[model samples]
Target chain A: MNPTACILVIGNEILSGRTQDVNVQYIARRLAELGITLAEVRIIPDRRPVIVDTIVAARAAFDHVFTTGGIGPTHDDITAPCVAEAFGLPWVIHPETFRLLEAHFPQGEFNAARQRMATLPQGAVPIPNPVSSAPGFSIGNVHVLAGVPRIMRAMFEELAPSLRHGTPVASQSWHALGLYEGALAAGLTDIQERFPGLDIGSYPFRRPDGRGGVTLVSKGLDPAQVRAAADAVQALIAQLGCTPIEGEPPP
Target chain B: MNPTACILVIGNEILSGRTQDVNVQYIARRLAELGITLAEVRIIPDRRPVIVDTIVAARAAFDHVFTTGGIGPTHDDITAPCVAEAFGLPWVIHPETFRLLEAHFPQGEFNAARQRMATLPQGAVPIPNPVSSAPGFSIGNVHVLAGVPRIMRAMFEELAPSLRHGTPVASQSWHALGLYEGALAAGLTDIQERFPGLDIGSYPFRRPDGRGGVTLVSKGLDPAQVRAAADAVQALIAQLGCTPIEGEPPP
Candidate 1:
């Protein structure tokens, strides 16, 4: 089984629709490439108790838990301390983190608020931030990173090598124009049952010009099974009187 | 208190990063306009037990629950039955939904799979889908919509009038160039304490030209409080030796 991961997006900006989340998709794609199954994603607020509860619950459920946002210098940046409380560990300022931030800022510029970023859960290792000096941290199975897309990507790239990988999933897609999903569903169900190990999905789309179609996708760890399922789906589409296209049809 | 809502995005495509979700932001913005607070969002896979569990938990936690996806004709479309199980109600085909689908599809095209879209939990009312004839259902406070962005938006717009609204939230924003969030954090904290009713957020951004800045946003139901907090934030930015700009800075 692939090592499973869950993402906790922590922020009020996202919940309020003030900010569109770019981190979930970035993390999900990267995890897929690393052969990790991205199981779930939760967009939560900056509430401490809720953060702690989600962290504890996610850690217990998945092999890896990634949290983004609330690790900055502001008063609302409470992720590090909350994470410490969740694990029942002491919130301590890491000497190395302090030194890095100290060097990054000019003399007499590092204030109390800046120093807050240096503090992290006990025994947590710093996740480097190439974009900004303020680093994220990883403790146990939880990796806490920045909410900003650029900084989050940098931190993830730095820490990704340390995560354990499983078998990378392979996927194939077949599309058919003028094919209603209702016509394809029964055959698709039969194909899915025949290849229990593979996951088959039927997505329907209607173009602006009023042309509509269905796209069938097959995904699995076994490349051969995915390919076989894709072939079957293509045949099914042809049998339904629609020519099967190799990739997604233009919307 | 504002009416609170939670969005449940049920799809393996989202978890696998094959599709970027456009529904959450749309729902969030629409709900905000309707004076409803979007509290949280969860993206889960096409699993039966997980879907049912999340539905039950979310229903118990919030005033409204909006679920997107898994209401199609395919085998993976199990949300209706799972929602029925969650409510301990019998899953049955709604006659109106069946009539609509039957009328929409061409003669002899309304197969068994097409009829599946008519199924709903007992005591549920159908939410019309203008984009697609396959109607979504609202059982109790849970409004089950489509995963497709166009269809989802249409369903939401139709249902928005029926939902109860609260006081619409008001917001103000101040931006400062070349201002580090660390330098402003302490003052922001003081302002936050003084204006406890307003939610203040500090977001930092780096421009493509390498200049960085911070944007402070104040949000609340009270417009006067939001404006007052924004003024204080601007003053704090000026005190830090940076000119505060209203609204977002040019990228």
Candidate 2:
């Protein structure tokens, strides 16, 4: 069984549509490589109550939970304290974090606002940021991360080694132009039913020039089963008078 | 108060890292323009129980609930039936949708698999799809749309005017190069406190060349308050000895 994970994007920017979020897709891909099932992804506001409640719920529900945004120096950056409140722990200044931050900043420049970055939940473990000096942290199952894509990527790559590994899911696909999903659905169902373990999917897409295509995918932990299902789908598409093109359609 | 909305993206492709989803951003911007607050966004897999439960919960929690994906002919496309189960209504074929889809296909091509596209929850109002004839539907507050970005955009635009409009939220931003967040955090907090109605945000970004900057935004329904907050942010940036650039930083 794959260890399930959830990503909580605690940013008003994304929810407001002011920002295009690339963090979720980046983390989702990383988790797949690590064999952790990306079960859920949420983009939520920086509201304290929402963050606290979601953190508590997500931690209890999934094997791992990652949160991006709200760990900055600004007032909206309330995630660290909210996480502490959720865990029923003291929001304290870690000596090492405080010292590292204090030393990094120029003399007398690390004001009370910058010091907020040093304060974390009592039991939190700092996830180092190579892009910026400010560190994200983890408390139990929830990993706090930066909202910026570059910083978030650095933090996750640093913290990823600590997460539990599961069986890696492999995928095989066959796609073809002029292949309607309705025409392929029946044969696809038969393939799925025959190999119950593999998840067979039919995705229809229309190209820019008004050409339509369908991509048939077989995905599972077992590579052999996925490959076999892909073969069946390829044959099925050929039977429908469309030439099967292996792999995903071009962007 | 603006009407609140939650967008549910139900797709294994998104979770599996096989696809990057643009549907959420597109819907979120539209909802904002319609004076609706996009409070939350969830990306869940193509699972029956999860879809039904999420639909029930989201519809009850938000004023409008929009779902994308899994309304296709494939076996994994269980959204339509699950929506019916959530509302405690029977899933039945809609006569108008059936007629349109049947006519769209050639003779005998409207098989059982293709006919599934015509199925809808009891009392569903079909939302016309200009890109593809297979119509999406709105049952209660939950509007079920397609996963495909092009089709979803067409469907949402057709159905957008029917949504209840609140005070449209507008935004004003001030950004500048080499402006660090810690330097702006204090004054930004004061600005936020002064204009409690406006949502003040401070976002830091690092360019590919390693040049860092900050974008400060003030958003709210009141144009005067939003503008005042933006002005204050501009002044705050100047106070830190940096020239303030009006509007958001360039991508």
Candidate 3:
């Protein structure tokens, strides 16, 4: 069975609609490639009680819980403290992190705020950030990463090797222009019933230039089953008098 | 008090990381303009029990619950039935929706899948879709809309006036190039302490071209308090010897 994961995005900027989140999609794709099922994603404000409660709950519910944002040196960066509270562990500065950060910053410049970045929950292991000096950390099932895209990507790479991977989940899709979803829904349902383990989805797309199409997708851990389902989808498109095109349509 | 709202995005494409969601940000921005506090956003798959449970919980917790996706004519479109189960209402065909859909489709083309779009829960009031003929519905506080952005935007615009709005929340931000977050964290915390009512946030941005900066933001219902906090942020930027930019930097 594939490991299940949840992403908790703790930030006021995302909730306030002041910032667009790109982290969730990036992490979701990576987790998929690593054979983990991305079960749920929650975006919440940077409230202390909310953060602590959510961390406690999510850590128990999924095999892995990735938290992004609220780990900066600013006053609003309360994720580290909240995580410590969640695990009933003391928040302390890691010796290695402190050393690395202190050396990275200029003399007399590593203030209390900068020092906060080096602090982690007890028994936590650091995930080094290649883009930035300060590191992210992992405590138990919860992996904490920075909010910045570049730093977050680097931190994820550092921690990816430690994660347990199942059979890599993959998908195949076929699209046919001018083929409407309602026209192919019945035949698609038959294909889905045949392959109960696979997730067969039918999506209808409409472009701004009035061009539209229907894309049928099949996804599962087994590549053979996924491809067989896609073959059925391709046949269905042909049966409906629309030429089946492999993969997504033109942008 | 502001009426709190939660968004439930129901789809497989989003969870699979196959689609990058633009709907959540659009709805969030609209809710902010209408003075609604977007407390939470949850992205979940098109599962029956999960959708039913989430709808029940979110409806009870917040003043408004907005759901996007799974209202189309495909087999994956299970949101209508799940919502019916959530409310414990019979999944019935609304007479008005049935008539509109029947009139919209050509002769002999409104199949079972197409007809599914018209089948709403009992006591559902239709929210018209200007982009397409099929209407979304509002049953209780849960407003179910389409997954497609163009259609969803039109539906939200139609339903916007009906929603209860509070004092419009606003925000002001000042950014500074080459200003690190650690340098201004203490001063920003002091500013936050002075204006306890406002949410003052410090964000660090890194560009691909190697130019990095910090953006300080203040947000609240009262424009005066928001502006006052932003003024303090600008002063802090100047004290650090970086030019205080009036707003977000260029993309």
**Please, what is the TM-score per model?**
0.97, 0.97, 0.98
Q: Estimate, for each residue in B137-217, the C-alpha lDDT of model 3 and write its tens digit.
A: 999999999998889999999999999999888788898889899999999999999899989988887688988888888
Return the clash pairs for model 2, or none.
none
User: Of models 1 and 2, which has the larger TM-score?
Assistant: 2
Q: Tens digits of per-residue lDDT for model 1 on B1-251? A: 99999999999989888888989999987888888999889999999999999999999999999999999999999999999999999999899888988999989999899888998999999999988789898999999999999999999999999998998889889988998888899999999999999899998877888888988999899999999999999999999898889975423
Ranking by TM-score: 3, 2, 1
Off by over 4 Å in 2: A249-251, B249-251
DockQ values of all predictions: 0.78, 0.80, 0.82
lDDT over C-alpha atoms for residue A35 of model 3? 97
Q: Enumerate residue pairs that collide in model 1.
A: none
Per-residue alpha-carbon lDDT of model 3 for A1-251, expressed as tens digits?
Answer: 99999999999888877788999989988998999999999999999998999899999999999999998999999999999999999999999999999999999999999999999998999999887788889999999999987789889989999998888886998987898888999999999999999999988887779899888889999999999999999999999999998876423
What is model 1's interface RMSD? 1.0
**Which lDDT tens digits does candidate 2 get at residues A38-135?**
99998899899998899889999999999999999999999999999999999999889999999899998999999999999997999998877899
Candidate 3 local lDDT, residue B36: 97
Q: Rate residue B132 of model 2 by lDDT.
A: 74
RMSD of 3: 1.2
